[model samples]
Each structure stands twice: as C-alpha cells, then as structure tokens.
Target: MQKTSYLKELVIKNTHEKNGANNSKKETEKIQSLLNLFSIANPNSGTGTSIDGDFGPATEKAVKNFQKIKNAAQTGVVNQNLFDLLALPIKKAFEDPIQGSNLRELIVNTAKNHLQNNPFELIIHQQGNSGPWVRSYMDGKEGSDWLWCMGFVQTIIDQASSIQGKNFKSLMPLTYSCDTVGVKGIEKHLLTRYQAARSNPSVIKPGDIFLIQKSNLDWMHTGIVIDVNGDTIETIEGNTNSMGSSNGNAVANKIRNFKTSKIDFFSIAPLV
Candidate 1:
C-alpha cells in the first residue's frame, strides 16, 4: 500500500457512519484501510475485514469488536475516539505483548532528545516561557505559565507518533492537569494504577506515566518512566529538578524507589 497521508486530511468530530448501503466508497475505503491495519496488528482479535471499500456486515462487526475492546460505546460507528485508536502505530512495542517490541525505546529516546537540547533555559518572563521547543509540545494551547510536565509528555508522544504517522493526543487524553491525566486515563481505559505498598515493579514499564500522590484526592506531579528494575524506576520528568518536586526548576532525569510512600499510583498509556 502507498502512504497517502490520509489521516492528516481526515477530520473527526462526531461519530462517522459508514454502515448500510448509504456509505461512500472513498470514506469506506479509508475505514477499510484502518480496519485492515488493525486486523493485521491484532491478529487473534477475531476475523479480519476485507479491504473491498464496502461497508458490509463484516466491516461493521469488526468495528464493533474494536469498540468493545476499547471500552467505547458499542454503536458500531466510528467516532473521534475510535478513529484515534485506529490511527495508532500497528507496530507498537510497549504494551501489547503480542505484536511489537521496543515501544518504550521510542518513547524514552524522544524524551531524552528534548533533554539533550535543554529547552528549559530558553524561558523568558515576558513571553511566559515560550520557545521553539516549548511551543512544539504545548500543542498551540498553552504558554510557559502552565505546569509543563503533562505538556512535556504530550509533546514527546506527539513527536514519536508523528514519526509513525500517528497522533499521540488522539490516543490519549491531552491535558496539563495531573489529576485530569489520571481521570482521562481511566476514562479511556488506558490507565493502570497500583498502590505503593502493593505495586509490583514488573507492572511498570518504560514509557508509562507515574503520578505522585499528594493526598487522597490530589496528585501533585507526573513523569515519564524510562526504565524499570526491581523496586526502582528511572524517570525523565519536566518542570522538575534535583529536589524531585513536580514544580521544580527544570526538566531532568530522576530515580525513585517503588516503595516510596508518596507515590500514590502509576498509570500506563496504551501503546498497543
């Protein structure tokens, strides 16, 4: 198949209907392409749909199955959320145990690349900490005043996804609030949280996001996991420093023990 860059041209707002005989061939073809890719990536996920560019019962069934797996509304119609999931890289390396490898390496490398450039030093008070690097990650939505840990993670994922012709924000919630990040993860069924005392280090993988719990109802910090060993995890965090506070001075790498009491829970974004 030729790379047509069709995803960039497709606009998703509400649910897209391609069922019955009323569907357009061009639109159905796009949907078929996505379903074909999805079927290939997730082979054991039941029967595959033919790329005939026709919205038959088989295509609708495949879409419905995908919706069920994603915990989305089983309307059998593709929506913005479903569209985003379909756009993810078929060759995921992080979460899915079946199809791919080295997914964490892609995420960690992207974060490290930003660290090497040291974009935090480019902050200016008048401009509210805006720079080429910062702006690229901000998604045209925020300035420097915003706590940027979420932005930093979002930016890194965005960069990595673009390289694969996918959209990271579409796959996960794009928010600046730590609390909201957790909520979005749960809503999207992509969040996995473990208690500090009961958590197993093996469950934590590189490229996952960890939330620092400040209280029962509040999470004060977040970072990207780069490496996970027995009871210890290394992170590349934004808006942090040597002190390890979420609102610290700059982006830096830090190591922490899984037994830390302050760590309320950690969440993993779906990359499979």
Candidate 2:
C-alpha cells in the first residue's frame, strides 16, 4: 500500500473511532508539536536533556538526570517549561540499534531487513470469474492486502532461513500459555515474542521475541531485538505499534518505540 493510505488508516486507529473530540484533538496537537524534548542525544553522558518530544525512556531518564543536575530534591517530574520541553512519552521508546559483526548483529540485520520489506503484507490472493488471479482476503474481510501475527512470523522465517529455518520448519504459535500452536500444525493462539526475551533478559540475543499486549490477556504482539547497547535495546515488531501512526507500516510496518514502563501493561519479552 502507498504511504499515504497507510498513514490514513493509522490515524483512524490512533485517534480512536470517534472523529472529533476536544481532548483527543488537543493531545494529538501536542504530540505533533514535538518529536524530542529536553534531552541531549547522549542522555546518559550527564550533559543535560534533549528537547525532543518522542517521550521514550531516554526523555524520562533525562528528566531525572536534569533534576539531579540542579539538585532540585530528586523528583522525576517535568514541569511547565520543562514539562513543555520534556513532556515525553512513557508508552514507547526507541534507541539506535547496536551495530556489530558478531552473531547478534548478524541475526538482527537478517531479521530486521527481511521484515522491513514486508512484515504482514502477504496477500491471501483471490480468483475472479474472468479467470484471473487476484489478490484477496481470507473471507473477503479486512481486504486482500492485510497481515496478521502469523504472516508476520512467516515473513521472518522466509528471511532468516539460516537461524531458524534449518532447525525448525516453522514456529508454533500458542495461546493462554497452556496450548501449543507451532507454525506447520499448531493451536496455541497466544504464543508471543516477548516470552523469548523474558526468559533470558540478562542476555537477550538478536532473534529473541518481544511479546506485547492486545485486547486479550495473553501476549499478542512480537518483535526482534536488533541491538543491545549498554543501556539501550532497539527492537523491530508488528501489530505492536501501540498507537496507529504514520511511522508504522501495519504488519511490515516501521518499528515504533516504547518504554519498559509502557509495556509494563503486557509481558514485553521474547517467547523463546
């Protein structure tokens, strides 16, 4: 789909079903006003904060750091000018991917690049009376060009042939933590990516899964950890964009940022 169409659908999702509300419009206006606020690029360097308003963990840390810089009691709060400057997001966060030639980077790039091209853009395909092969949806619902979690995982499998392909034909998705739904012939509806990372938070590698929340209780979203710097870890995922935004590409959508604080609502680890 074109970027414009993608963005239109996203705005609808992010803004909620209701068209116009005072508070909603105001909030949207605020977010649009800034990207990064009150924090230097290297926030941990102790050089103060950057004024960007993306509101990931860095801004939160920057706020705390700024408080420490001024010795202003020790509250992790951002006020007025500082609030306007540092009113960052707690729901999402993104840090630069750690670069390397090591196994982690190799796997991350393999996964990231592959998914970036088409995460959930797989078409179910359609057949027309004119005897033409057409792109169609599974029950003629949600349309022909739509992708869900299964497609998201499959795309990665096609791309990361070396890492998981040879060992396992396909990954089994599960649901409610008690079922089993392997890719080829499985049934667990909720096996998520987050469980993979949580099991080994101390040493999360590139291919680990990062489970995020959906309407149900079990993990519903997934992502791959691309980099793991000293304190920052960058991930690429789908359906877990949290908010509907232009930055997201739906399934093969662009990865969005989130803070550990934000994902606290759901398990945000790899489901190994």
- Best by lDDT, which number? 1
Candidate 2 Cα outliers beyond 4 Å, as residue runs: 1-106, 115-147, 162-165, 170-200, 214-217, 230-232, 239-248, 251-272
Off by over 4 Å in 1: 1-101, 121-123, 126-132, 140-144, 194-198, 264-269
Candidate 1 lDDT, 48-139, residue by residue in tens: 67656567788888888888877878777876567767744421221222222455667778777656544341333344434323444454
lDDT, each prediction: 0.61, 0.34
Give me the displacement of residue 154 in model 2, in angstroms: 3.3
Task: List model 2 lDDT by residue over 57-147, tens digit each.
Answer: 5544544566675566444433333333322221111111323354345446655554433322211123111000001111122333233
* Prediction 1 global C-alpha lDDT: 0.61
Candidate no. 1 TM-score = 0.56
